[model samples]
Target chain A: MRKLSRSSGDVGKKITETIEAVSEAIEDTLVVSRKFARQDEETLGNAERIIDSVLRRFSRAASGLTESEELLRTENNAINYEISDVFVALQFQDRVSQILALVCDDLNKLEQHLNELKSQQADEGSSRSVNVEQWLEELSKTYTMEEQLTAHDGTKAEIKTDQPGITFF
Target chain B: MAKTILFVEDSASVRQVMNSTLTREGYDVILACDGQDALTRLDGSKIYLIISDVNMPNMDGLTFVKSAKQMPAYKSTPIIMLTTETQEVKMNEGKAADVKAWIVKPFQPAQLLAADSQLIQA
Candidate 1:
């Protein structure tokens, strides 16, 4: 029998650090994403409001301007439409933030599961999987995300949430 | 009276988007954060449809759909899974739960609206 080197590092500390790191990352993401998202939303909303006000104010002022000056109105209208398009495009961030939030949730669950695995590892050499197979089955029944299934697919861990397809069950 | 749809999703932005869109389309929307919350929202209200995210905190979509189907009113009320998953195992699990439709996420509002209309009309 080949004897592997006995590792002296504290496994408990490593697991604790990993979980803490994940929690910290999640908190940081939540704080930063929310802050930036709020700023982005305000910027977009103000742009729309400014556009609306400019359009209303300019259309009235345009009545008194020369034909050449009225060309600026057309250009302003185009600019406002472009600004609106940018606002719509920024909505993609909402979708991305939603996905990132879900990732944090998974990290939280992973920490819990890791803690459970560590506890089982310390209790003799009994296989936790063997003892908890039934529990695992029921545990999956409580799944709440498509990512959970994608993670277990054993193929490419591709998370294609943007694709639109429907199947009847 | 407008038709009521129960939407179970954990994200506030997603819920807001869906609620606004559906409300604009003349439907009343009730919301829940997850499957367990969805069960509580049931509250014997007349719901025309149930749309849910597959992965959620507290309870998952598959189990919720299965549990909801156990009820008489919900058995006939169609359910659509709005998720990012395309795995056969997940599809099978949803099928077992009696989910009527599986619409992958990042979907167009029209796509789901069309499905909702078709199912409701049927």
Candidate 2:
């Protein structure tokens, strides 16, 4: 099949459109995620702290009251169940944080894709014409382009490839 | 001294390029990664304008604008949303959030810098 080429200008506009859409989606996710982070970050951590406080308070109160040993043991057992409940809540919090991380990762990918589009536009602008489908196909074959760095502890050190592969959609 | 402009973007590379270019143009440059972080750094700092990326981790640009607008100190601040997309809905959302301008990404550096100067001088 003959490859159809797009002018640098046209490709620039198309890439801009795609990047804007992805950026907006990321913004939407960011809105929700920020709210979650603000409201939820210390939620589980605070719950655990509160549980400890409650147990301490119960122990102090039981010591003051002239209750039977069995009664005090029953109160302790109830508090243990409550502590278990707090653990369950903490697990939920952890899961929610994980989901937010996934959202952040997707948004980061979108941002990177936008950067690639711009770079491609610049490269095309420099060259005057580019095949969009071929470019995208090549991008699809590669994984994500993440932030990376390489440095040797000493001079004349051999270079090694430590770059992660892109996970294309 | 040139008017100061603050840029809040998450990407390290973008931040570096923007800082270098903006500083070269005689503008005082301050940088932050996200909306909340920007707010933290804004105290005692005189910023004539703000340019922000839409999708950030701790705080998005629009929501940032919404919160910033509510602050009496920054009520008149001219906030611009920089993005790679040009969706109408997103623009409208930004408008409602009181963002002063929306710039689609891959912008020409000349045009972006020119716009910044204009906004700062105005």
Candidate 3:
């Protein structure tokens, strides 16, 4: 199992290349230090081929790392777009909350209006000066926003629940 | 240079989420809980844009836009009203107040960003 990190993509190539380069440098230094040692051309040639093969593999591994980084970035962008969409959708909570709050506001106003009606009747010693239509008109004043007005509009027209934008004039 | 956006919303949770999204995109965000609070926030800073909610405790969105336009510094600033109200009368009032954009609630980020990019300069 490989744990992916921001820099992990470069780790494999760097580690392999660094180890190979150091080993070659150390071997060449050893050869140079042994001044009186017998020169083995065949052994040295074999060592060169082996190092070349390792270096080629390291290069391929590095290329693979670049490919992996590209893939990871593509996937990340896709998830981010989805997350962005989700965040956008989540704003419905605010919309619904606003509507409910207005509904509650209407209810509170209605209750107050009813209480005033009862008080007027009680003060008059009978139900005489209580005009329900006038109270209804006053109730409409409590409703300010369009949604509240729409709810009060008695008609067959369906209320537009979707939020529409007006960008141009 | 990062642009500063004033977001006037009553819902704290919505503000937090929107703040995260806008700030992640390198925009400096100033928050206001209502229209009155939003009024206090407009202290002569060079605000790039404003995103406001319609229904609030102290003052509603249309009134806020009108009040914001009264401030000489923010009269022509790009204002986007974000709310659930979809009435033509209210929108007309907003237009009169120099609000160029009106975004409905539950709006997409791309929609908002597009409006912002179109309105806000570099």
Candidate 4:
């Protein structure tokens, strides 16, 4: 029982990491939403996709984490809720960093793409609708650029970037 | 071959450390996170010893031991209760369940190994 009790602690830590990943994904989505609003529509669209991707990852991660936590509860037979919390916090840092990096990378790309499009067409547009149209065009251009990014490397970037952008308030 | 030991614990970090430690000590360690699950795992395995914790959710350690002792297979298997608290009443309750030993928590791995050998040998 002593040895098994110790093993249950390990399962609890894995559940902790899983929960942290879910939380990180949620935070990242918020960041993506905010960042998309400040940029042109093209940038916003890309940001939206990134947000969606993060949301999906969060869902999957949350489910896996929940199941694992349940598994731990089922296996340990004993309740030591207080000690479990400390271990979860300790394990969360790693998962948080990984989710944050993915979010950060997607957000950064959207910002860069939007900046490039704005610089190219900034002076040519006067009406907000024209700017909107320009943003849409830039979004298409970014799609191509993103594709090129994937083509250059064999790695498949599964981050989704297809949602409508929130306009800056 | 070292005797097979089954450990049922709820905490994750503790489980990893024990799995590694017990596995290294030449004992085949099977882990269950809860008492109900432990009972399931016990079905076909040759478990010579049982190490479990008290105050767990789903099924507490004392309850688990009492149920296991009723099983013909585990009736005589040496059982140890691990706990952070050394309450006399709890120890007596465990004795009623046929537990062979009680080790206070914050146990050294070496001490546990020694206890296992001594109790199993006896």
Cα error of candidate 1 at position A53, Å: 33
Of 1 and 4, the candidate ahead on DockQ is 1
Clashes of each: 7, 7, 0, 33
For candidate 3, the lDDT comes to 0.78
Determine the TM-score of chain B of model 4: 0.94
lDDT string, candidate 1, A1-169, tens digits = 1233233245667888999999999999999999999999999999999999999989877775766667888897776566434433433444456556756775687678778877888886665543456545554564544555455434555555456478876
Docking class of 3: acceptable
User: In candidate 4, which residue ranges exceed 4 Å CA deviation?
Assistant: A1-169
Residues B1-122 of candidate 4: C-alpha lDDT, one tens digit per residue: 77899988776666676677678778889998889888888786568889887756799888888888888889998988766433466778888788888865445555567777777787
lDDT of candidate 2 over B1-122, digit per residue (tens): 78788898876656766787788779888899998998887675567888887767899877777877777777777777776334567778877777767765444455466677666666
Q: Return the DockQ of model 2.
A: 0.02
Q: B14-116, model 1: which lDDT tens digit per residue? A: 7877787789789999999999999998877689999998877799888899888888878889989987565778888887787889987656666778989
Best by lDDT: 3
Q: Give lDDT tens digits, candidate 4, residues A33-54.
A: 8787667777878889999999
Residue-by-residue lDDT tens digits, candidate 3, A39-108? 5666788799999999999999999999999999999899878866676656666665665776687678
Q: TM-score of model 3, chain A?
A: 0.51
Considering the two chains of model 4, state its CAPRI-style docking category.
Answer: incorrect
CA lDDT for candidate 1: 0.76
